[model samples]
Target: MTPEALSGETLRLADAVAADLEGVERLGVAYSGGVDSATLLALAVRALGPERVVALLGVSPSLAARERTIAHRVADLIGAEVVEIRTHEGEREEYRRNDVDRCFYCKDELFTRIDDEVARELGLDAVAYGENADDAQRPDRPGAEAATQHRVLRPLARIGMVKPQVRDVARVLSLPVADKPAAPCLASRIPHGQEVTPEKLAQIEQLEAALIDAGFSDCRVRHHGDIARLELPADELPRAVAPGIREQLQRAGKDAGFRHVALDLGGMQSGAFTLQILNARGSL
Candidate 1:
């Protein structure tokens, strides 16, 4: 919807986010070019001005190349300066273990880097990430704990803006990624308890890029040892299994080093394997 089409409630929520950043001299946003973060960045730029806001992107193998490119494009669209930081989450053994809290270690590394380097050099008074209200209440988001520990502000969650509200604000701001699907780190493709390695992440990225090339943009290639468990949205499942498309997907999986390719009938799910592990361990 256009900016003029935004409802009063949505506009009020957007104003609340800007109001939350009132006293900060300079702000650093943990941006990933997704709808939530993009909306936050756009609003922050509007409130604090583009010169006062910096988009900090943590570059690592976990981040897909395509995603990184999109992130830069989005930041440029918002007229905010982009800073790329190297995160060593992979060097942390706890992160490499790939537990349910893997995101915690990754986020911890990113925030730590920002605190040690970016904050001081860039004169940033505060940091924020795009955690919406829905994510604030979710059990799957251990990364929120890291954000809390780092004293990073969550304007969207603080303003009680959920995913739909965030998307609405994004559309109102004319952000390019307003309707983009959520794309988690490549490491999430591995089942919980499986060790996260650069190889696995690269393989998952390769197959996913191939899937996008084959016309399935929103999909997941869960790395299950020798098998690549494909997860596509329900509506795309039929197309995936079609004769020509099925063979294309199979070849893509094999080219990515999978011995067998399997399509999950349950469809694409966010944090699917992690939730299953959490359930089995009675942590849910």
Candidate 2:
């Protein structure tokens, strides 16, 4: 859609993004199929045409299969070609260390892979990510530091567009993930100090997908060794405790190889593990 097709602040926001991306012959967006990235992809397509834009999805054990499918679907919807780049952050000891800077290692590996393997072949003039104003200011995202080191463009954050603005732009563009809750990497569900492994990630994915299939719209199956800590939205907490739902969740958790299934009454939290660690260090 053209900038004239949009109106008011959304139009102004879109214009700002287009202006930021001007003069780039070809652009690649680091896409995760989340609303933020999806919005950036859509905006880039609008600005530079789908032919000049590519959505680069980093495939790894950390990324859920469902998310991968969604990334492709969203790219198709936005008229941008999708390129899957297999990342090996798992091979990095720093990433497996699972400390607060784990995201930095993961992102660094992705950017390095892109720089070494993708940019030249794809003839990409520039690369951008979906960091919004809120994420730009957040202390928990060490991945942002990696983006800075790689000089990845952050149009949304640069234009001061926050989460709500990104969602609004998604709505204007009719993106499917407009209201989708934040779905961090499967590794994020594992607490700090815990080694991130494919097995743990698989377990988390299985249980989280099961929870979604069980009718909970927003949920997290946090991996705590053998314990599967289930977190659902506060409003859905009562339904989750209902006899049938509770039993189903218990069965699902067990099927995912968890020794115990526990509900977090505080509800689903975004970046709970990272925030907890950062807070403990008095960093935030």
Candidate 3:
């Protein structure tokens, strides 16, 4: 669609989200600084005013510093009260187990904390998140299950908004993250079954930041034992393999403590390792 047409659709979606929030006396957003959550926060602020809308960011070892900064900036732009809650997902054995449902335990800890501290203490009417219609159809998002268990509201999903719709609305609202790439938790880089550690998370974050500094967006530095498997977009493979770029990346990985560095020709994908596991189990 043309930019203008997309903008129009996005405005409509934003209006719908705002309408839903209008009746809420006080609403807390599960803000992640992602385009989806940022867009929803913008709408909530517009609907309930800044005083009634609270943007809650769950801080954990898995959270990237950049992500937290962006989320705070977005909340500032909307004049919303941003609450940074330090979460101990790593402390939870179930979460640190790194199973397929690891996200479930992480989010469960998050929402429960929000419910106890933010909602009850602050007297918020509801705690909402940015899950959209597209995510509703995705089977592997265990976090969504936790959100449901905690009775967290999903305004975008409730309004029938999908990924494209959220992006469109974000553009209409002029959110800085309107076109930002998805950046899941740092622990996501570790293959399932590997215990998530603070040091490992820090290493992944630094390596990914270096990759971005090297001009590779939408990438992942997947942790595999002593090896770092870089996943660049398929279209960027040629650039990534240019004369000295591979060596540079290898050095960066080695500095991060990887003994060997390899590029995955299959390229960047969300939950690539999880998909591999699911496929191996004939679940996909």
Candidate 4:
């Protein structure tokens, strides 16, 4: 679809979300600074004004430092009040178990803090999170289950807007994250049942930051104990093998404490590991 047409559709859907939130006296957005959440936060600010919208960002071992930094910047640009809450999902045994429902525990912790404390303290009448239509259709997203249990709102998904349409509207709204790629929690880099650790998450974050500094916009450094399996986009595969570039990445991986560095020929894919496990179980 044409950019203008896509943007138009996005606006219509965003308006639908705003209309859904019309009765709320104040709303707290479970913001992650991702395009999905950022777009929803912007819509809420437009609908209820900045004073009525609060961007509740959860800080945890799973959240990458770079993402946390950008989240604050995005909230500032959106003119929404930002609240940083430290979530202890890592300390939760169920979450650290790293099962398929790990996200469920993490999100449950986040929403509990939001509803039980943040919302009440801020006098928010409602709490909403960004779950795009595509995300709702996806099989690997267990976090949505927690959102459902908490009765948290999903404005974007309810309005029938997908990722592409969210980006279209974000571009029209001039959101900084308009083209920002999906960056799930650092814990996602570890394969299921590995037992998520702060060290592993930190290592993943360092390696990913190195790749980003090396000009990779979207990448993943899957933690496999002493080995780091790098996943870059198909188009960027050449760079991964290129002279000098390969050496620099080798050094970066080594610095991050990986004894061996290997690039996945399959290239970059969000939740590739989880999807593989889920598909194996026929959960999709």
Per-residue CA lDDT of model 3 for 54-149, tens digit only, reads 888999889989789888888787678888898999998988879888899989999989877778777798889999999888767889999999
Question: lDDT tens string, model 4, 21-101?
Answer: 979999999999999999999889888888899999999888988999999999998888999988899889999989998
Q: Give the TM-score of candidate 2.
A: 0.98
Model 2 spans > 4 angstroms off: none
Show model 4 residue runs off by greater than 4 Å.
Answer: 1-10
lDDT of model 4, residue 92:
91
**TM per prediction:** 0.96, 0.98, 0.93, 0.95
Stretches of candidate 1 above 4 Å error?
A: 1-7
lDDT, model 3? 0.85
Q: Is candidate 2 or candidate 3 better by TM-score?
A: 2
lDDT for model 1: 0.92
Q: Which pairs clash (backbone N, Cα, C closer than 3 Å) in model 1?
A: none
Instruction: State the local distance difference test value for candidate 4.
Output: 0.90
Model 2 pairs whose backbones collide: none
- Per-residue lDDT tens digits for candidate 1, residues 1-284, read 23355558766876797799999999999999999999999888878888899999999999999999999999998899999999999999999999999999999999999999889999999999999999998889999999999999999999899998888778777899999999999999999889999999999999999999999869999999999999999988999989999999889899999999999999989988778888988987
Per-residue lDDT over 121-208 for candidate 2, one digit per residue giving the tens place of the 0 to 100 score: 9999899999999998889999999999999999999999999999998898889999999988989898999999999999999999
Number of the top TM-score candidate: 2
Superposition error at 178 for model 2 (Å): 0.9
